[model samples]
Target chain A: MEVLRLQQQLIELTNSLFQEGFLDDQFTQLQMLQDANNPDFIQEVVTLFAEDSERILAELTKTLETEPIDFKRIDAYVHQFKGSSSSIGAQRVKAVCVDFRAYAETENREGCCQALQQIKQEFFLIKSKLEALLQLEQQILAAGGSLPVME
Target chain B: MENVDGDESQPGREETGNLQNLLCGKKILVVDDNRVNRIVAAGALKKYGAHVECADSGKAAIAKLEPPHTFDACFMDIQMPEMDGFEATCNIRKLEEIAKESGKIWHVPILAMTADVIQATYDECVWCKMDGYVSQPIEEEQLYKAVSQVLSRT
Candidate 1:
């Protein structure tokens, strides 16, 4: 009785994510890349984005106090962070980088500091959403079902 | 001039001024849960000669309306707590319909501002059919162009 309800719930969660724009076609593509061959591929990648972005943010923070605001160093970090966020289809974080670079170009230390805060706020949001999606994947598996195809 | 605060290169003030021309005289709304972004964004928009307003989240945005109250365009930051941009966008569409009046009541363009920019990001923008987008840390020209492009057709 409950199993049917559970399946329906999983479907609903997937759809909700779609409507929310939390999961886009690329995320669907990520889901598609998985099969019995690699059940955890999407989840693994999501975790990696979560991890890598944290390190870049940390690196950027360490350099914030440099005199004249060494923008070369700062842009390098934003560039790297942009790449990682891009890889996982984290649209928001990468977008933040576009503005972040402008802040660096202007040597706006305060702007850069503020940008860092925005980046952190958005980075963790993607992390949690992907984590939730991964949990849903687990639920589908536990329910004696295959991964849901994102249409 | 009245609104700018944290920008460096006071000498580059001219450069910033050229950048501001992108949104010249435009009416804009900056939606973000963060106050700092609100301040920075409003300042940027004002530099471009834009009239700007700020809202913390989707809910606050929905509740905000001063008569003759309409922006030529809106910049919405996704991932806000309480009510995120996607839901807010959808809801704003509804509100616009209810608040509709003559003299260009058809559409109000909303430019999505986000820190994440990926294929997923593009897909979401498409899915939402947003009028425009400017990624976070927000470039002066890019932000202005996105707003201008959306506003021009309207």
Candidate 2:
């Protein structure tokens, strides 16, 4: 009963990851780095994502607030965020990065902030979706089932 | 939706060949994390009469590939949680030997899809050796072109 419920949840999470693109190669490699020795790999990686995202957001905010907006600095910051998000397959955030980068390129401070806010929203969405996925995985294991199979 | 670009888009269907039967005999694998995305892709390809399978992540996609697999091509999303398109594509490429040994008609093609459609993004696509790519906000005609270009097996 619980197992079946968990299975459904697991599938939902998996689908969200696909829709959002947070399960790409870089994320997978991070997953592969996990084992019984370090079972908290996924959690650790998520924490990193959260922490890193916060830092990037902070920097983006600072740059946007500058009277004479530093577009180059903003571009660099966006570029960094873009790479990290790209590696993890954070589709929504990565998509936002494109806009932010363009705005930075043009030194459109307000546009950069707008893109930042959007990325922030997407970040939370992906985070929640991933938490749901992780919870389902734990439940599946608790139910004595193998992880949900994709495909 | 036959390329419904609000009457401002280009041709809906390609005139090169009968795309309906183009992939009739081809087997395709859709590797994406989202079920909706996978279903959308499969549903679209099914209209063209091709057999379809789906993987929720890169990890899942790799596990499904075997000598017995008869995929003419794969439509892989760039980002997935378990394994990414790049890794999955590499894995599929490595399976070429086994695919040949199994007497399959042709080697598989891998196409990358993403919402990340920028100039740099395209360069990355080429870097990944993606046979083809389709941008996000995916339309029917764009999808058809991608599938047709990759599935030119018939």
Candidate 3:
């Protein structure tokens, strides 16, 4: 009964993420790629994404604070951020990055700063959500129940 | 599951080309400065039964191609730090030219694996003499198609 409840929660949470546009089809592709031989593939990729995003975010913060801010450098960092976020299907974060890149291209400091904050917000939001989801997955597995497949 | 060659079902072989078979026994090199990107690409290629090797940077990739290069194909990221894909491809081409001078004629096809599929990006890829490109996030069908296309040429 507990396993069933966990499964239901997992499914519902996953549906909400997609419905709210927190994730995209790319996440589904990642899930599909995970198999018996590589059961932790998604977990590994998510961990990597989170770590990489933190590094890029820190870089963006530092670079933005420099004198005579180099928009080119800002653009490059955002581009890297965008790639990693999109790779993990962090749709909201990736969306902010698209706007962030445009602001950087135009050398708009105010616009870039605002976008940076926006990106950071989205990143943290998704990070917590993903962490919750992964934790729930672990709980289900530990309870001897298989993960619920997302429809 | 062990059908690495993906040639087990010969009946539907012609009609439906097995996706896994496309990369069977092929060796692929994936170069990306980003750790996550490299892991993602390598994982996907391994699923398709391709022996995969990785280089964290363009310089590392160049080092791997020292001599008697055995990689069947390479997927290179475009916007890496230090040395980008275009520069790496240029350097690799120079090495190929040197190898050609020594009476070895070989060109290992390089596919630009990038997130930006813009017109300018494609233009630059061509200008760098790249065979083709695959988009980032590494979709399976696209990866297979690009790899098969390049492998067929050589």
Candidate 4:
């Protein structure tokens, strides 16, 4: 019964994440990659995403702080961030990165800064939601239950 | 409604099993500057039963391939700091030529792993003698398909 309860919780949380636009089908792809042999697949990828995102965000912040801002370098960093976010299916963060790149390309300092803030806001929101989802998965596993299939 | 015995019925299990069979015991190298990229690529390949080794940069990859040339295949990441994938692939081809001249026939297949899938980007990989290309955010099926395609050629 504990397994069932945890499974239902995972279902609801995942649904909410999708409904809220924090994730997309790519997240489902990531989940599909997990199995008994690689039970930690989603967690590992998410953790990597979290670490990589943080580092990229810090670099972006520093790069934007300098005079005569190097738009090319900023674009490169944003490109990397966009790729990582898209890879992990962080939909909103990736979306903001798209806008961020446009600002970087035009060398618009004000626009770029605003886009960076949006990216941060989206990243943190999705990161916490993903962490919660993973925690629920752990709870399910601890209860001797497998993760319920999404969709 | 569906049985979840953690068996073949699982969504990707059968495909994963097939990939493991195709890649099992194959020695492969993953070269990428990003630790996260390396980990993700290595993890996926390892899950499919490939014996995976990694190099943090193109130069390190070249060092690993010198003389011995033991790796069955390689996944080379583009856009590294010093030597990008194109340069690295070119160097690897040079090494192959030298090995051939020395009466040692060695042709290690290399696949470019890039986030950029532009037509010109792929053409550049082929120009540098890379066997094929795999797009980034590496999916399991795509990785397996690329590996199989490259291996099939040789």
Candidate 5:
């Protein structure tokens, strides 16, 4: 009964994430790759995404704060961020990064700063939701229940 | 009692299993400067039963190609601080040439792993003599297909 309850919670949370545009088909593709041998695959990837995103965000903030801003370097950082976000299926974060790169390309200081803030907000929002979903998965697994698969 | 056979029938399991079989006992090197990317790539490769090694830079990757360390293939990331993937592949080809001259005859396949999915980027990889290409956020099937294709050429 506990397992069923937790599974329901996970399913609901996952649905909400998709409905909210925080994720997309890529996330589903990611989940499809997980298996009994690599049970913690999603969690591992998400953890890496979180760590890499935070570091890139910090570097971006510092880069934008400097005088005679180096748009090339900023673009490089944003490119890395886009790769990581896209890899993990953070659609919203990846979208913001695309916008960020456009600003970087034009050397638009104000636009770059705005994109950074938007990226940060989207990244944090998804990160928290993913963490919550992962926690629910843990509970279900602890109770010897398998994760609910979405079609 | 709830039937838990769902996990067994999850999508991509069969393909993943076949790929794992193809990679079993293979010696592969994962070259990347980022710790997270290294971990993710290595973890996925290791799961497929490959003996995976890590090189944080292109120079280190070249060094590892020398005596006492041999690999069947390498997954090289495109961007790094000192030497990027293009330079690295060129250097690796040089090493291969030297080995061939010495009668060692090593033809290790090197795959370019990157997020840049433009036609120009792929053309650049081919120009650098990389055996194949795999994009970032490496998926199991993509990794398997790339490695398989490269190994087939050798």
Candidate 6:
């Protein structure tokens, strides 16, 4: 019963993520790569994404505050952030990055700052959601239940 | 934990998939400055049975491509710290020229792998003589098509 409940929770959370546009098909591709040979592949990749995103976000914030603001430098950091987010299939965050880049390209300081805050919020939202999903998977495993396949 | 699926005809295949064996026995080099991208790209290639190796930077990739190269193809990231993909590809062309002058026919196909697949990036890749380009967050079909395109040409 415990395993079944966790499995139900897992499926619901996974579906919600996809439905809410927090993730995309790329996330499914990431899941597909995991197998017995790499049971923790998703966990490893998500951890890396979290660490890398935080660093990039920090750099963007600091660069935005500097005088003679280097839009080029901020764009580069945001570009990296965009790549990593999309690599992990973070759809909403990646969408904000697209807007962020356009603002940087045109030297729109106000737009850039607003987009930065939006991107940060989206990143944090997805990060916690991913954490919850991973936690449910862990619980299911502990109860000797295999993860349910997401359609 | 019993092996339930007994469709064990292809013994050498790395993972379970219809796409298995598409890149069997092919050695691929993945060049990227970002660690996650390297792992993700390598994971995708390995799924199709390719022997995937990685270089964290363009300079490292160049060093790996030294005389008597063995990689069947290379997937190079366009942006890096010291040496970008275009510069690396140029340097590689030079090396190939040297090899050609010595009467050794050699040209390991190079493909540009970038997150930004804009027209400008594509134009620059062609300008640098890259064989093909595949955008990042690589799709399996797209990657396979690009890899095979270059592999068949060589």
For all candidates in order, the CA lDDT equals 0.66, 0.67, 0.82, 0.81, 0.80, 0.83
> Which stretches of model 3 miss by more than 4 angstroms?
B1-17, B119-123
Prediction 4 TM-score vs. true: 0.87
Evaluating just chain A, the predictions reach TM-scores of: 0.85, 0.83, 0.98, 0.97, 0.96, 0.99
After TM-score superposition, the amount by which residue A115's alpha carbon in candidate 3 deviates from its true location, in angstroms, is: 0.8
> 3 or 5: which has the higher DockQ?
3
lDDT of 3 by residue, A1-151 (tens): 9999999999999999988989887787678768887889989998998998998899999999999899999998898888888778888888899889999999999999999999999999999999999999999999999998776
lDDT of 6 by residue, B15-49 (tens): 33434544777899999888778888888878777
lDDT of 1 by residue, B42-131 (tens): 654664577888888888776663224667778888766678787787777766666576444545677887765552276676666567
The model with the greatest lDDT is 6
Query: Candidate 6: which stretches are off by over 4 Å?
Result: B1-19, B120-123
A1-151: candidate 4 lDDT, tens digit per residue: 8889889888999999988878876677677668777888888888988998899999999999988799999998887787678668787888898889889998899999999899999999999999999999899878889878787
Instruction: For all candidates, state DockQ relative to the true structure.
Output: 0.02, 0.03, 0.31, 0.26, 0.23, 0.30
Which ten-residue region of model 5 chain A has the weakest summed lDDT?
A24-33
Query: Per-residue alpha-carbon lDDT of model 3 for B74-102, expressed as tens digits?
Result: 88998898999899998988888888989
lDDT of 4 by residue, B1-154 (tens): 0111122223366667778777788899999887767766776678667899999999999988775667989998887778988888888889888888989877788888877677327578778988888876676656667777767554
Q: What are the runs in model 5 whose C-alpha is more than 4 Å off? A: B1-18, B119-122, B139-145
Q: Which docking band does candidate 5 fall into? A: acceptable
Candidate 1, DockQ score (0 to 1): 0.02
lDDT of 1 at B60: 79
Q: Please, what are the lDDT tens digits per residue for candidate 5 over residues B35-100?
A: 667766777677778888999999999899763356888999888778998898898888788778
Residue B98, model 6: lDDT of 88
- Superposed on all Cα atoms, the candidates' RMSDs to the truth, in angstroms, are 19.4, 12.6, 5.8, 5.2, 5.7, 6.5
> Model 6 chain B, TM?
0.82
* Off by more than 4 A, model 4: B1-18, B140-145
**In candidate 6, what are the lDDT values of residues A11-52, reduced to their tens digit?**
999999988989887788888889987889999999999998
Pairwise lDDT winner, candidates 3 and 4 = 3
TM agreement with the true structure for every prediction: 0.47, 0.47, 0.90, 0.87, 0.86, 0.90
